[model samples]
Target: MKKPVISGNTISIPSNQEFLADVDLFIEGVLRGYEIDESVIADIAISVSELVNNAICHGNKSEFEQSVKVCLKWINRKVEIYVSDHGNGFKFESIDSPIADENLMKEVGRGLFIVKSLMDSVDFKITPEGTTVVITKAIQ
Candidate 1:
């Protein structure tokens, strides 16, 4: 788990922030291959990076033994990405709104908000094994 591993459209990396750039590069490259607009690629990349960061930091708790997995797919003129981490899941509903007046000045806690704002849809799948975040954005 010292380095990122790539298998087709999926990339798995140890729970470390250093590999965030690697994930971003892989994702942006794939999006570009489909000739997606630059703005759309940036939006998707930002969302993916935010999710991956959460997977490494929050989901995996920065434990090197844990790993983060990201999978990308294109379907129906849309791009869907799934990010998973090996850790107990949390209650998504409990997250306070980032735009709330009390949370507006906080330096953290904005990742999910940003992801949801940029992507067409965001869903969470929680299981005893771990949590997975699925995000989709239309390419057209």
Candidate 2:
């Protein structure tokens, strides 16, 4: 597994699932530095992990040569995270409802649902280069 490279509020890693722990540690450490509440940190961390996993498994197709980048920023009291992947984008609206009875048993397609449920807002920007998911959470 390739190691994650961290620079300031951004971390880039090869598209592999093993570096997920590195991402979680980096994000939690940044949140703690801002003196964020533990519960809120956990929520943000979980949401981020979901997005990162999707970016790796779905977006980049776990290609070792491709890289996933996570960037964090603070605007006023709100924290914004951007997860970008170098893969062809997918239709955002086309995803089926995970809560539906038919989809309830499926293990996939719930990452974005969980992310939206936990974060204040989530947005996706899909371009030829890649797809970038931005999630925001307000700090109390």
Candidate 3:
């Protein structure tokens, strides 16, 4: 497995799930440095994990050669995180509702839903280069 590389406020890793813990550690450490509450930190962590998983699985299709990049920024007591993957983007609008009766039993597809619920704002940018999901939460 390729080790995660951290540079400043961003971390990049091969398209694999094993390095998720490393990402979590880096993120939590930064949040702690900002003195964010444990509950808020937990919510941000969960949302980040979901986006990373999506980037690894659906975004990069588990291609070991591809890379996923996570960038975090702090602005006016709010944190914004961007998770990007080197893969063809998907149509965000096409995702089925995870809470729908027909999809409730499925074990997947809840990541975006949960992220949206936990984060103050969530947005997606799909370009020819890749797909980036931006999540923001207020620490104040």
Separately for all candidates shown, the number of backbone clashes (residues 3 or more apart, or on different chains) is 0, 0, 0
Give stretches of model 2 more than 4 Å off: none
Q: Model 2: per-residue lDDT, tens digit, 5-57?
A: 99999999898888999999999999899999999999999999999999999
> What TM-score should be assigned to candidate 1?
0.97
What are the per-residue Cα lDDT tens digits for candidate 1 across 1-103?
7899999999999999999999999999888899999999999999999999889888999999799999999999989899999877787779899899999
Off by over 4 Å in 3: none
Worst 10 residues of 2 by lDDT: 86-95
lDDT tens digits, residues 20-127, model 3?
999999999988999889999999999999999999999999998889999999999889999999767777679999999999999899998999899999988888
TM-score of each: 0.97, 0.96, 0.95
- For each candidate, the alpha-carbon lDDT, in order, equals 0.92, 0.93, 0.92
Give the runs in model 1 whose Cα sits over 4 Å from its true position.
Answer: none
RMSD of every prediction? 0.8, 1.2, 1.3
- State the local distance difference test value for candidate 3: 0.92
In model 1, the Cα lDDT at residue 104 comes to 95
Worst 10 residues of 3 by lDDT: 85-94
Q: Which scores higher on TM-score, 2 or 3?
A: 2
